[model samples]
Target: MITIWGRLNSHNVKKVAWAAIEMGIEHRRIDMGGAFGFTDDYLAMNPNRLIPTIEDDSVPGGFSLWESNAILRYLADAHAPHLRPEAPAERAQGDKWMDWQFTFAEAQRTAFQGIVRQGKDVNDPQVSASIAATIKLAERFDAALGQTPFLAGKAFGIADIPMGVYAYTFFTLPFERPSLPNMEDWYAGLTARPGYASQVMIPLS
Candidate 1:
């Protein structure tokens, strides 16, 4: 069985676990990050000291992987290549949005931290600015979803997982959010998926 190390509350870790569940991969998860501290052995596998590291004993030499997206790709390549686009150009279309989440997160992080973690003054100039930027990012996603049924086009794939996790936090937050019908519909579709509902749609802690 594959071994996964991370806390369920982590968004990055949720992505990995969601993928594993969606693919019906047999694995065991260890509660390891955040309040659950990592051991010295954990540090050896991932020097970055991040959550959601995985050990796949099935691979030659017993592969250990770090980085949630890398783990997503590895699982797809190893078990379900159908989860990714077959053509290079099509794959790139999916890749662009998957890569875009980090940049999007940088814009959204301050407001999320302020609103969810610290309960900072929502009207603070910095917080308001961050919220505006995050809305703009969502508008971009809304526009993209208008064209394709999924981020990777017609089919659900790795591209959807990152934003899928973010959408839960974004929509449920108490902040005033602009209504993007297309984005809402897309998110509704995600909520219907068993993997997304159980793994990605948990209460953001």
Candidate 2:
């Protein structure tokens, strides 16, 4: 069995947990970040002090991994090869989007923190600016989705996991957003998945 250490509310953590569930991997999760605080041992495993670190005892000597996207790749490689495509070119279609999610996150960070964490008004200049910037970046996803049903091509894969986690926050934020029909359709399909519905589509923290 593998041990996943992180709180459910964390978007990064959610990616790990949701992938584990989607791939039918046997694992246990412990809330360790945010209000739960981190232990020295946790820091030893991930000096970066981030959430969603995993320790897989299934390996001969045991293996510890960090970085949410890296963990998703590892999980796909080790336990669920089907989650990722085998052909390099086919896989890159999804791989690029995995990295792109970080950009999307950065674009929205200010708005997310201001409104969700700081309880600032949407009209706050900085918050509004961040939201606008985030929306602009989202157009890329909208355009990509228009060509493929999923970011990872015609099917959902590792690539979809990262953005799927963020889409919940983007759509739920208390602000009007320009219509992105393709993204909306993709998000609706995500909600239909049991793993996404249970893990990613939760009350935002």
Top TM-score hit: 2
Model 1 bad stretches (over 4 Å): none
lDDT of 1: 0.88
If candidate 2 were superposed on the true structure by all CA atoms, what would the RMSD be?
Answer: 0.9
Candidate 2: misplaced stretches above 4 Å? none
lDDT of residue 113 for candidate 1: 83
Q: What local lDDT does model 2 show for residue 111? A: 88
lDDT scores for all predictions? 0.88, 0.91
**Per-model tally of clashing residue pairs:** 0, 0
Per-model TM-score on C-alpha atoms: 0.96, 0.97
Residues 51-96 of candidate 1 have per-residue lDDT tens digits of: 8899998888898999988888889889778899989887888889
Encode model 2's per-residue lDDT on 5-117: one tens digit a residue: 99999999999999999999999999998999999999999888689899999999999999999999999999999889888987998889999999999988888899989
**lDDT of residue 48 for candidate 1:** 88
Model 1 clashing residue pairs (backbone): none
